[model samples]
Target chain A: MAALALPILALGALTACGAEEETGTPASDTTRTLKVGYISGTSLGPAFVADALGCYRDEGLTIEFEPIKNPADAIAFLATDKLDAYVGSPSAGMFNQVAKGAELKMVASLGSVNTPEGEAAPSGLFGAKSIKSVEELKGKRVALLGSVGSATSYLLGKSLEAGGLSFGDVELVTLGSSDMVPALKNGGVEAALLFAPETQKAIDQDVAHALVDSKKAYGSSTTAGIIFGTKLLKTERATGVSFLKANACAAKRFEGDWRKDAEIVKMLADFMKVPENTISGGGLYAFDSSLAINEGTLTEMQEMFVKVEGILTYTDLLPADKLVDDTLRAEAVGAA
Target chain B: MSPVTRDQEAVESTGTWRTIAPGPAELDPRGYARRRTLMERGLAILVPVALISLWQLLAGAGVLESNYFPPPSDIAASWADLLASGVYQESVLASLSRIVSGYLLGTSCAVALGMVIGSVRLLRVALEPTISALYTVPKLAILPLLLLIFGLGETSKILLVALTCFFVVLINTIDAVSSVSPRYHDVGRSCGASRWSTLVHITLPAALPQTLTGMRIASGLAVIVIVGAEFVAADAGLGFLVWNSWNLGVPEHMYVGIVSISLIGVIVGLVLRGVEWLLTPWNR
Candidate 1:
């Protein structure tokens, strides 16, 4: 028993020493606030740019990021009006909520796929050395962003169609895109549905190779977007418009050889806590200065999700135009 | 002796335990006792019935957003839908299998280690602090690291479940074993019991009640962690069903998963109580 004392004390010391918050809280004022729920990722580059540049502040809006960890939380918060806006994936849940007569609207694009210039979707299914071809993915485990039959799943389904396989052909594991690199290295999965920065980083490391480009399947797509809850639409239309305008300007700033501008890159780097190199040319979530929602892509994704979740019939489907409010987008487009 | 101490004694003794009746003024008159108990039981069930009815009414009246806050009828329809698709069966099987396997694995190791340490005071003091500290760290925080080591398969989830169950079982086992009256050890020795016999017949039975209590608590904790584990990387389970349904924006299916877990907790807890009743008949 006496011999046991030392080890226990030592172990206590070890676990107790390093437990604390890793990042500091953001500063905000009580006057004129907009709470935007978003996940932490490079996909939010436009918002990050707007946030860092004080664009919202210029318009007398204090931005509060809700920092959503799960996609579901975003939906609930938006539905309950706890969030004014949320940037996230276009899932069946978002569409179904609209169909059920929730006043939430897709206000502006959050992230999009390849452009007319031929840059494929920056995210895709990537394979290990052992997985040389799409055909080889059969029966192998794959990591995907979000959940099954999501945007990531749609991409996987496309590749599977080409490879004579299906979503059921391989074992699918749900993991975040950030976890994909280590997941790939540790054989957590044989392949992963990777998005930008991570996809580029993986390829640069030569650990995983692209198997299917989502951009190749759904060319000119809006993957996720900034959604305005009814509370914001009704109570603070100007704030919502201001949010889009700020983001549009940020998009233009990013679009304008902002990569070469040291101060802007440094500001983004400091705020996002990434190396300037990673953020500078970060093909993060390629956003057009227009901040426009892809009308057709939303309709296509909605139809696909309605069938996939098995909750809705084809007859229950509506066109994407019903869900998006072009009011703020037009304002941002003209003003920015 | 006071009524409370009498009940306590009955619980600890080999004699059959009986609950003491309240004094004359405390309960209803003799003639009305049966009716009183009936009224009490009915009242106990009334709250839940009323609440559920109100929830249903509010939802049907569109007081609640059916899209996010789905009605009970919609949730029931979802349960039927899940059953029709066989997703319900698969998810239940996956969750139950994981919970049972992890709880057993965790509790066994904890009980064995707890016995060794609890019997020795210095070991208890030395280890308990570390155990307490580790327990305070949220289990999900380490899941990514676990995924790195064990990958995103069943192994990582099972390991997390085990880890979650371990601390609760360990701390309880320590307390239970330490609480065993020294007089019981004296009695075992007087019977010419071997060291092993003293531990098995005397030490173990003395700690059995609390150990069972710990197991009950750990099982609940195991369910929570299993759901959390599934939330991270699993493709199938009640947790996966809830998370996937929520992500898909099907509130009814999410409610189905939530209700299923609540039922499982009640069922498992009742089963544990039944096991205790059967095993400790002398303690009533």
Candidate 2:
């Protein structure tokens, strides 16, 4: 009896130790905190805003943001339930995950690149100084953030096709988004398709020239960013909706007066690790924060993905119904 | 004095032993054979089989989560998928070709340089200290510099493998040659053998075993270094498969890559053993 009592005491102590290590709180609590994962990319903006504004707390969510180094990692975390929600591009990777029977769904549109007042957004295709025109880029090397199946690669291909050049006419190298700028500067690549601030920085350095503004060629009607996860929408639907509401509010605050809200811009710039002047000069577009996942845009994206099945096949890329749930977005927008 | 007395004594001893142990006759050859077979089988096969069975059971029961520790069945299925898709074969061929090319080139150069230095005391004094100092530094620490200079391409990877192979082979060659007895040299001189002939026949053969051991060691190092090189900025190879799978969040595929790497190591070890057996059969 004494020996048994000793083991029971040790077991109790061990159980307490395990609980403390796991929750870092008293073991008596029944609730588990929400774990949100995000990459240090554009997706971080909304999460940062939500945390800073206490919007998650307002919705009664204890949120923890896990930093991811890549979009693929974020998607993987979501698939494994390690993360409650993540934002990523609607590429073959997302489709592949869904096809593998991962219980996940795309919930809302976070941001988009579109023209304001029917004017083309200022996007650029930069190349080395030696290249004079898009014609000169033919048979030359160009770099994209991923392989041919990636969203950036699709956009680049579409832009090149618009310029009367085929993807086969150029060598497409796979470089990460962060590496693209340096790769261009070092002459490792003949050209690169980059987003706003990096594009502006490249032009300022005079190491690369703008070949074309992609928005003018591809049109403003495209889905650029999305919020996705399954468990978060299922269990913490209100908190998820509140997150979108907070994003919409922050977007309005950021867009209402870009000149007066210098602090907001500085915060974003600091997080993105770009110079304030560069961010200011880049002229980032103000996206509609309605939380709506535009079906027409997604349908168009699906068609584009199907058309480029040679690089990656997503013949059954989810239809509009499976891709999004607009009821939450509508409710969040109405509440806001 | 003795035949009849000896027979009588043997009979008396047998009767005394039988009185002490009164049971069925012990069959010496059968019992010995049975024990030998059991010991040999237990030591050679049963232990490994038991360990593998335990592993499979743990994996099957999902004691460790599937994502983190996939079952052996899953690894086998993945292996089959890769093989059928031709990816596994191509990657294995590519890695093996690179290792063989780099190992041969590096080992040859090391052997030549080491022989020259070992022959001359002045050269040995000049080179050995520098070589030893450089050898003490981990080879991986210099990889970033190698990448900067060579770019993250085939050349840089192969160069690193070769560099690792060179150090091992060079050190072993020097030691082997330096350890040759002075008696052999004296005998050769007495036999009127020229320096070149003596080295070719006596010294080279004497050093072959150690040189082979160095090659074996470098061969393993080549595999490790090549895998590491492939981890950064690679589009294909077993290492790239592991890296891409990890990034893509396919931990199952990562385990598949790991198992493939282990299989490659086993095959290389077996091949080196065969070579050793063929070259130095007299040792057996």
Candidate 3:
């Protein structure tokens, strides 16, 4: 029995090793699964919309929306086997990852601030009662989230520059944007970059007030969008194209007067686990109508990453065209 | 001391000395007074070199992906670049300062409280169960709460480290004290030694080995808690460097951070071991 057990155990180990991620066509080919990691915040509205409206199902693609606590985590897993796609900004973090040869491809536009059709950018510079505007942040501590090479810092920095103050002017504190509300309340940080429900939560709690919206300085920006890992983009692009089509449909439905729709409001409220009334009110993120990944905005983002953050040298800059593939978006739009 | 006495002392060594081993391979070779053999030294260097060479080989052969797992050469280059920039030194200094301060405070408080608890039946009965229960709770769970209480500055990081260290030291110290044997106490009483004298001379000496082991454990915990806390919220630390590097897809820089943390653990462990050698010479 002991001699016989070795081969059996080896077979079992081989089977376990073979049980990797889903690849090739499934036995049931009708429903192709795309594991998309996204934050629960409003920035990832289109994915939520697609999941709710059954757009993914309609296109024969099952988008498993892995609601990541922080979208920043998805960036790390974007190139690996863990995640297929993620909704996040074109920050230095993402750019550097691509430069490092993480097989991540920018596929679709989630939305940006420029064409804030029905959605308005939910994130803004919030601060305690003492600070009122960007100018007041000079010499005061300001908490920024999304890591060191974050676009939020650039947004804040640009705004500060307009007021004759640079990044060095303020004492920068690093903390999660979600935790910033309570931090502001208890005076952990003087100012913070908060988004969506957390911002509303702070405002309702009467501890923090909106100081400056980044859109004013950065202008209508393509904050984040859908990105594909090397595996799906290389082997299963048909599924990738289908996933983008679903996003486009979701974006169109969301752009077509979603604020007034009680169903969408309730869906978003339940999805976000916030008060139903919070969805009905303002402070919702405006997604782009076309769901188009703009090359210019990405270049602008890369430039800021290089000049503002010094994350990458000018020589290391991978052009926006190389980073993004417009063919998938073009196909998705045509199919939609 | 006489040569005879010296030989006897060497025979009954505490093992603190890294004396050369007598084996078939090294029996013929001349041994250093108290040093590892060339064979040992060669093996020591060989393992890591072989592993790293294999890593580089796999990477060059396309078996190991350089995207996630970088080559040692790349890691070395990044490590050198970072150190040359001076930020590495500043971050290491900041983290080390926090770790030392927190470990000292936590261990000191634990030793005091543990001694009292072990000495008094009432204190032990009242507090021991509660402490043991609290020790099982994950220290990371209280990080956000610590932030709320202590704010997002260095205070929260220090407090979290101290909190984690407190449990390990307290539990070990209590166990060490309780296990020192009641016979020692009885002997002290017969000798007409005062309670303080009994504790200081007899019980404390008996418990020193266990307590030092606790300190060593607490030292490692301090490194872990500080790194984790820094990863959650820190602008300057090896953890921050690793995290930011990982996010930015710089494998070389990430590996540098990885190496730095391992180096911290090694240095801290060696320091604790050296302290133990001083405090508990016989046990060594």
What's the TM-score of each model vs. the native?
A: 0.82, 0.74, 0.84
Which of candidates 1 and 3 reaches a greater DockQ?
1
Clashes per prediction?
Answer: 4, 0, 4
Q: B1-284, model 3: which lDDT tens digit per residue?
A: 22212344656676343345445444544454234566688899999999999999998887977777778887888778888888688778878988998998899999988888877878888998899999988887898888888777788888888888888999888888888899998999999999899989987899889888998999988888888887778888888777777666566777888889889998999999998998877886
RMSD, one per candidate, in order:
14.8, 10.5, 11.0
DockQ of 1: 0.38
lDDT of 1 at B99: 90
Which regions of candidate 3 are displaced past 4 Å?
A1-31, A70-73, A114-121, A231-236, A269-275, A308-310, A313-316, B1-44
- Worst lDDT window (10 residues) for model 1 chain A? A18-27
Residue pairs with colliding backbones in model 3 are: A114-A220, A119-A286, A120-A286, B14-B284
lDDT of 3: 0.75
Tens digits of lDDT, candidate 1, A1-336: 878998988865542332111111122332367788886655567786687788877765688887787766787789888888887766666776777777778888865655435554567778987898888988998888776646567666666655677666888877777888878877768988777688887888889998765666656667667888886676667567778888887777655345577876787777677898886666634658888777776776665555454634234667666678888889767866
Candidate 3 on A99-201: residue-level lDDT in tens? 7666677787775554354444566677799887778888888888765466566666656655677666788888776688877877878888776667778
Residue B267, candidate 2: how far off, in angstroms?
1.5
User: Where is model 2 chain B poorest over a 10-residue stretch in terms of lDDT?
Assistant: B16-25
What C-alpha lDDT values do all the predictions have?
Answer: 0.77, 0.67, 0.75
DockQ of each: 0.38, 0.13, 0.33
Model 2, span A238-265: residue lDDT tens: 5566566655665555443242466665
lDDT (10s digit) by residue, model 1, range B1-284: 45533676767786777766676545557647877788899998998889888999998998987777778888898799899999999999999998988888999999898888888999998998999999788887888888788766678788888888888888888998999999888888889999899889877887778878888998898888889888767889999888888877777888999999999998999998999888777667
Looking at model 1, residue A205 earns an lDDT score of 85
